[model samples]
Target: MHSAIWTAVSLFLIVEGLGPMLLPKVWKRGIITLISSPEKLLRRFGGAFVVAGLVIFYMVNK
Candidate 1:
């Protein structure tokens, strides 16, 4: 379980790096846009991701 968690995190980091690595200008623009977004909108977007992740995890485990 511990190793599995670390592997998942490592994969996530790799994926997170791809945007900046492959398309730095686009990624920077996206980061700037996200920075200007409203706090409430960001919260809702983050919450959606959390819920979706939880659903995916549950389905995979089952």
Candidate 2:
């Protein structure tokens, strides 16, 4: 069970980490334009997902 939990956490981190790091380079101008918006909803949404994932992992492990 612990191994499975760790595997899931690791996978989540890897998948989430890759996108922001990779996508900006691939779509440099587009990413810049998107982030520049006054609303910035996407950043907030992504941050929420990351926080939720971390919280889930913490609860499961603890």
Question: What are the TM-scores, per candidate, against the unseen true structure?
Answer: 0.97, 0.41
lDDT per residue (tens digit) for residues 1-62 in model 1: 99989999999999999999999999999999999999999999999999999999999999
Q: List the residue pairs that clash in candidate 1.
A: none
Ten-residue stretch with the least lDDT total in model 1: 52-61
Clashes of each: 0, 0
Instruction: State the lDDT at 24 in candidate 2.
Output: 59
Summed over model 2, clashes come to 0
What lDDT does the true structure give each of the candidates?
0.98, 0.81
What lDDT tens digits, residue by residue, belong to model 2 across residues 1-62?
89997988899799877866878566677668777866768778789989998899799779
Give residue 24's lDDT in candidate 1 (0 to 100).
100
TM-score of 2: 0.41
Error of 1 at 52 (Å): 0.6
